[model samples]
Target: MADRRLAIEAWESLFRAQHEVFEVLSNDFVGTDLSQAEYDVLLTVTRSPAMTARLRDVTANMLISQPSVSRLVDRMVGRGLVTKCNDPDDGRGALVTATDLGVRAFRAIGAAHGKRIAEQMSRLDDDELLALRALTEKLRAGVDVDEA
Candidate 1:
């Protein structure tokens, strides 16, 4: 029990540190109209070979609720950043894809984010990076597949 508590606290600390780093990167580096959530959505869609995804897929990938994703997608559509199209295969599902403007915005912001992360982590040696990845993966193993 004590070991679990200690692990939880350590995980929280790591999460906080990562959040702080993201905040700094977000504020000073990626200063575009796109929010972090939007950027993530765009990246997930763009990374896929089809460069498109269904609403449910976006919600799952973004780790957000359906309503939340709907609202966000609504906003993105309003901004002409993305489009909601009827899925040809499934008449009921909507396919979401980034617009040309959305792709442009994503590229600009993503480059900045990548550069920021690279600059921040540049001081870490290869061994330290590997250690961090191993530790984080170990902590991630705590989440049961059944729970997921």
Candidate 2:
């Protein structure tokens, strides 16, 4: 087993690094029409098949609460960035699809944001980036296992 002190230090380092990177990258959204949370939703929805996704899936991928995601989606709906409809397979479930406006907005921001992400991540060499991705995925897999 790893030493408790070492484990704690590693966890703190990971947390702090995430916060620092997020803080820096979040600046990419400063002048955008969408907030960070809204962008996250669009990113997921836009990447899904037919440019649509289940609301539950969106909530699952988000860092916020279910109710918070619901409210955010409602606001996005009002803005015509996305449209919500009842899931055909599940009467009680909702589906969200990006509007044409949403696609254009997301694509514009995504192109710029992608460049920013690449620039920010360029701090690490390729090998280091691969290692970091592996470590994070391992950590995430452990959490998934625990949930299962």
lDDT of 2 by residue, 11-66 (tens): 99999988998999899899889899999999999999999999999998999988
For each candidate, give its TM-score against the true structure.
0.80, 0.94
Stretches of model 2 off by over 4 angstroms after superposition: 144-148
- Model 2 residue 5 distance off true place after TM-score fit, in angstroms: 0.7
Per-residue lDDT for 1-148 in model 1, tens only? 5599897998799889898887877774345678888988898888866788887788877767779998999999999999998989998888899899999989988887888888888778999989998987886778785787
Q: Local error of candidate 2 at 64, Å? A: 0.5
Q: Residue 138 in model 2: shift from native, Å?
A: 0.9
In candidate 2, the residue pairs with backbone N, CA or C atoms under 3 Å apart (3 or more residues apart, or in different chains) clash, namely none
lDDT of 2: 0.94
Candidate 1 wrongly placed segments (more than 4 Å): 28-31, 141-148
